[model samples]
Target: MSGVQDQLEIKFRLTDGSDIGPKSFPAATSVATLKESILAQWPKEKVSGPMTVKDVKLISAGKILENNRTVGECRSPLCDIPGGVTTMHVVVQPPALEKGIGIVQDIAQTI
Candidate 1:
């Protein structure tokens, strides 16, 4: 007899200290899908500038996660120890230098 693997309810803790969600998905869900969800739920008010997928990264248990991997594939030690639910970390990278650092220039003008 075969039984289904349980879906995971994953919450995200942002590097900016914002909490995103406890979104649920199947264990086989792709990392690309997860990132899309995060991008959707990200707080627009919290943004200092424009955001992009390339600026977002997900980490678990101190390890950077790859977009092609599944959540289950990247499950961290914390996920197993925390009574079953998984919490991932989100890091927002600085936008590419091509973006011109307009926010920084604006801040300098204010100072």
Candidate 2:
């Protein structure tokens, strides 16, 4: 069988606190690519650039989320407990929305 056929299925959560269904991807998928996929799912919501993944935390089953570490960097000892490789939790911080110039002008006029 091909490597892709043996790839594992995992679930990822969006920054908006939404649960994304399990997806099949190669084990070699980078944390950065995962972040991009999450953002793409929610096009309407504002999301920070690549750097935002630095703040994401991957939570495994039973294990609590403590420090901020990307899945790629998280390994044994830190989160290598048994039965911890299947499920993962990612914390994504949505991008901030700025008021339009016209809106600001209108508010200023009202003041």
Top-lDDT candidate index? 1
Residue range with the least summed lDDT across 10 consecutive positions in model 2: 76-85
Candidate 1 off by > 4 Å: 1-4, 81-83, 97-111
Q: Check candidate 2 and list the clashing pairs.
A: 46-95
Candidate 2 global CA lDDT score = 0.53
Global lDDT scores for all candidate models: 0.73, 0.53
TM-score computed on alpha carbons, candidate 2: 0.44
Q: Cα deviation of 26 in candidate 1 (Å)?
A: 1.0
Writing each residue's lDDT as its tens digit, candidate 2 over 50-111 gives 34554454565545444433443433355443333355666543333224666888899999
Give the 10-residue window scoring lowest on summed lDDT in candidate 1: 1-10
> Per-residue CA lDDT of candidate 1, range 1-111, in tens?
112344777888987676877776777788778878888887878855326667777788878888888877877654564335577888777766646788779889999
Query: How many backbone clashes does every candidate have?
Result: 0, 1
Instruction: List candidate 2 stretches off by more than 4 Å.
Output: 1-6, 14-17, 43-55, 61-85, 94-111
